[model samples]
Target: YGPRTERSKLPRVKVAEPATPEQIQETRRARAKAKTETPTLKIEHKVPAAERRCTVCGRTDLTTIGSGKSSFVNEYVSSQLVREEHVQEVLRCPCGSCVITAPGAPKVVGKGQYGASFLAHLAVAKCADHLPIYRIEKELARKGSPVARSTMNELLHRCATIVEPISKRLLDLICTRDVVLADETRLPMRNVPKGKSKTGFVWTFGAPDELGGVDIAYQFANSRSGATPRKLLEGTSGILLVDGYSGYNDIEKVSSRRRAACYAHVRRYFFDSLKTAPIAQEALDLVTALYRVEHEAKEARFDESSHL
Candidate 1:
């Protein structure tokens, strides 16, 4: 294992003729199961409505008085966003200090619509549903409230500005956490300063800490280079779980910093192999071993805290 010696190419072994019908059926079933078996976020229970009561006074009495539902119909876009409109006025004040008024719907985007709730729905639509403002405006016009696309864009920027402080705080907590998972995904952003039409990269850092569980931070950079991760993780010391990218190697340059390879990345190679060269069963088996280890670890509920 010192100096690698080149090996002579072995004669390619012919795989038995293409799988039979039965074998193909079995492969189909296994692939379907493997695709469906990927782990996902598990939310156990919803927080009780009673739990939202005021902490100062034990008043479990709260009721919604006026409620209305609005339908925003757009014939142009093949999407319909139906939302409930609510007007709730709380009856009791725990300490008699303030009367809590929670509006039913948002009216910010649409003139006749609910303000905060509307803004919130629009924000969620933009962020989660990935809908552009012009489309949303057209959708709103069908419902009677005509919202301008430019206004929607400004609203989003305002919302982002409002939440940026919270994002910075959470990001700070994440970067200072015990262990962090670092990765980057491509983001399409205009780099006008560089006078180029190329897209920017969004460096993502997911860190877990006892204080705030997991915090995800994203930064848009002009390029995907080692310097980005190096700068983000500079002066940080922890095990970084990342895809085996050379960019992460720069972390080791900082004394005492460690890196762990993502099993998902290793599994992806097997998937690619299955698609490109299905006959490479030996390589497939090696990848399968990696999945087996991950499965066993998950079943054991392996606590990464031990490494702390």
Candidate 2:
């Protein structure tokens, strides 16, 4: 009876209703003050002007000499070039004997509408920014450029061709490297015809050899067959850090091989199976323990630098 009386004596509290006008105005002012207290960020882009001038005497004086068929007096000079806005102009000299010619402006991309810097921006936007070409074309139109998607495609193709030499050299470096990591990811080639789901594969190889720095190579292929690894890594040797993909097994000829699997991949499979598989929780616990070990290793300088 005493416990029941004490429980009944306890008071109940109610939740507050909507704020009054004064409180609302105060809240709005507080928010405005917070916004004013924060700093604003601004971005700027600058493009350098293109110009040409004389190397010697630093004078703009120039003259054109051409190979007008020379019998003995009136001669045409082959050195004469068609004038354009890109071509530099100089003050004409009376005598055609000595002509100080300014070399034509260097082109980032030759003949094509897009410049070198523009191609670079486009590549970064596509690869890093994950923007599709169609979106980029729309953006260009918004900026008054009105660039076509086909033009963008041509630009990308030309850029890829131009950089192929560097890419090949990097691939060669990767091939020579004793330590390497190789993997492939699927890319949907949507341009292909219907019912043909053309699944393209992107092969990435990385790490360095006796030469110097790390080199990465990416190749696109129509197939992701086991033989794909064999084709890309022919005559390659040493440690190949990769995911648990059976396709890599076709390249067993790799010398002094050591396989290090991605722990994240193993964790992902166990996590996905956790709902149905009773043993999945146990596997997850083991993976969590491994991750804790990795975390501890990262925090504490446990291993010697050479062993690391």
Candidate 3:
């Protein structure tokens, strides 16, 4: 009776209503921006000289006027390949003392038959768009420029060789950042042995970019070894954010390099303990708040703004 009276003496309190699932989802969604259908690459269809004349009277002479009708077309233009022949002229001195020749066309891959633009298209098709080499060969053949599959394979290899220095520079820049995120994922190599299988891993290092993304550089290795990361991160002095992988443990050996916790990995532990401990909910809530803050900052374009 005393306990009931004490409970009744307490003031009445009300709890705020939890947001509906629909409202929560609405808050999390990113609204699409209104699109302006303006195209940068526009091809104008000019009237031919023969058709420029008056159609009804067939008059030869006519004053230039505005267009009779106009309409816009949304189109997908297939890329085409063109053969380029550079003609260099040689000039001889009047006294027959010396000869001079015009500079030849630039070599993208040491006198390679294909131009840089063509090679770039192939690289983007393979790496960015994930198109198979055989598919690319067929597409080009349909477009009237049939290239051999082996030739494309060699061209892609040469392109990778040409960009080796750029890859190193990108890694260097990533290392210069105060905080770097690193991870590795398994992928199968197509060049494995005929009978036995081989597993490959692509380790990626990431740095924050102005476009609200993590600018990443990656390397392919056959094994998930600490030595790989040690070699890749040589001369690096910064904190690394990565999953609790044993391969990254070598980074702790270096006095200059330190390891930081990955929030996603940490959150998983708390989430798994939700059934056992109620206090884990608080930790999960904090992580959710952190993610919300990051989303809001991204929406505000805070990353695009410069500090210096």
Candidate 4:
């Protein structure tokens, strides 16, 4: 379906109930299982006992077919979120002196209605997957966790507020690395003034060799200025890889940072000149040869630190 026009009411996700003693014991005894690399969800449809009969002359007798044939086709499974409702106990003195309520689960956002898992799912779907909020809203409605798009957006903003410190810490750590690549892209602001649209830039800095699954920090600005990148490259005494952007010149001037130009940008100039000038073909050929050597080296498991 196309974009939804009507403001539909969203249904709340199913609340989790308190587990029984037996169920709790069973859950505690459960062990972690290794996951399959290939497709694991194989839904096999079996013939019912009442219908498992010979097709010839309505005969009821049939021999075992030894695990009948199965055809596999990819299918979609909708994800539904469940809410964990914690029912805390309340204690009061007989003399009505004081009352106390038991503590609940840790909050991702203080006193937040949604759980951390729900907030994480929404953040990944929107930020990582670039899924539209309306589509996410519709998906939730289709699955049983029907949450309003507005509510989801609000929760995401709150989640961001909670994660802001973590992101800053990651970015600070990345900046301290000896090598970092930085790039920027234009972003269209949706909730800007209605008369005219406003544009912002999203800058990302990554230290390619940095591990431990932490991401590079990003900075967002309304204007594309050298200050935005200078701030990101602050205290970066190592090499900085970037595209053909003069904004980073200030970074090289102020700091003892080794600025490395991207080969993709260098090749693009020759690539565009190929149509107008024939001499550019030789440069393109050399670039292609260089890329082939790099590819070969990668196939041979060669890294920057690898010798020979």
lDDT of 1 by residue, 244-263 (tens): 77877878786356888876
lDDT of 4 at 107: 85
Name the regions of candidate 4 deviating beyond 4 angstroms. Answer: 1-77, 90-101, 210-215
The whole-model C-alpha lDDT of candidate 4 against the native structure comes to 0.77
Judging by lDDT against the true structure, name the best candidate. 3
- Candidates in order have lDDT scores of 0.68, 0.68, 0.78, 0.77
Give the Å shift of residue 75 in candidate 2. 60
Q: Give the best candidate by TM-score.
A: 3
Report the C-alpha displacement of residue 200, candidate 3, in angstroms: 1.4
Segments of candidate 1 deviating more than 4 angstroms: 1-114, 190-196, 209-213, 267-283, 289-308
What is the lDDT, from 0 to 100, of the residue 295 in candidate 2? 56
Q: Clash totals for all models, in order?
A: 9, 7, 0, 0
Q: Give the distance in Å from residue 35's predicted Cα in candidate 2 to where it truly belongs.
A: 21
Error of 3 at 296 (Å): 1.4
Ranking by lDDT: 3, 4, 1, 2
After TM-score superposition, the amount by which residue 208's alpha carbon in candidate 2 deviates from its true location, in angstroms, is: 6.7
lDDT (Cα, tens digit) per residue for candidate 3, span 1-308 = 12321111111223224666875665556341112334546456767887887879989787756755555565776789999889999999999999999999998977778999999999999999999999999999999999999999999999999999999899878877877889898887666467666788988989886556777898888888877788877667878899999888888675377889899889788777877986777777777767666765554446556431
Q: Least accurate stretch of 10 residues (summed lDDT) in model 2?
A: 1-10
